[model samples]
Target: MKYKAERDCKTYLDTGRLFAPSSKSCHVGLNQVGSLPLEVRSWTCSNCKIKHDRNVNSAIIIGDEGLGLLALGTSTYCP
Candidate 1:
């Protein structure tokens, strides 16, 4: 069974990058890898210079992916 975290990580990897929650143009690639093990829930984007919550960031990505699928006429559901 695939967990949401696995899907979220896959989404990030396939996109080849991550963006700041506050500044969509700001890239934060693999910079937070070390922070995850420490159970870091939030961080400041170097480019955006704004803090972002981990849960919020993941929700945004997942929401966007769902919207993309909806626009493509794909069902956003699992059995």
Candidate 2:
């Protein structure tokens, strides 16, 4: 038997831009430089100056990317 495993979007640009937890109000994505360490659970966006939860932000990014891929007709399964 053969099996295939699905994966979540895990690629973060080395520029760290992907790590940016965008500000909901301004919709700005900024590199989370020096942030998101193991102990850090949240951060404030420099653009909009809004605080964001790290986990929640990460989830949002992953979801968005997954949706984007779907919209592109790249994947039929929802990641």
Candidate 3:
């Protein structure tokens, strides 16, 4: 999934220093630095007040995991 700040003045916040593993699904993980809490399905940034998409964020995490070395090298198919 692609992340695009709603406004040109706004920028994405990165919270993760490195790859973060998924707590539930092996095929999912988060790569972006700063992210919203799991309890928060959606939120407006304190600074920008722009609505954030939770599904988009989760999709990005899963996409990152899919591109990882292990996922790409594994013969097991994932869909």
Candidate 4:
């Protein structure tokens, strides 16, 4: 995974704009600002009011970033 991440960060000659399709607005994280010891493993987005798991959100962000980079044409694939 680390190797893939590093590879994605590289710059590509094509320079085509890349964007990650995300549903982040639907899961804007918990609204409890100072609350500690979160009772649930998941929370609803204040903006869209959609429920989301902490782990799932993290994975989405990471995958989005990777895909964003890939779309930029910085892929390390030597084909």
Q: Which model scores highest in lDDT?
A: 2
True-vs-predicted CA distance for residue 68, candidate 4, Å: 0.5
lDDT (10s digit) by residue, model 1, range 1-79: 2366456543212322353332222223423333343276776766557676776766666566556666776543433
Q: Give the TM-score of candidate 3.
A: 0.32
Per-residue CA lDDT of candidate 3, range 1-79, in tens?
A: 1144424433333425354433212222223326446775654444444454665655555556556635545433323
Of the pair 3 and 4, which is ahead by TM-score? 4
Task: Flag regions of model 4 displaced more than 4 Å.
Answer: 2-40
TM-score per candidate, in order?
0.48, 0.55, 0.32, 0.50
Q: Sort by lDDT, best first.
A: 2, 4, 1, 3
Across 1-79, the per-residue lDDT of candidate 2 in tens digits comes to: 0123334434322224554544221224644545456686767777667777766776666567667666766644435
TM-score of structure candidate 1: 0.48
Candidate 1, residue 31: the lDDT equals 35
Error of 1 at 75 (Å): 3.3
lDDT of each: 0.49, 0.52, 0.44, 0.51
Q: Which stretches of candidate 3 lie above 4 Å from their native place?
A: 1-39, 44-51, 70-72, 76-79
Clash pairs (backbone) in predicted model 1: none
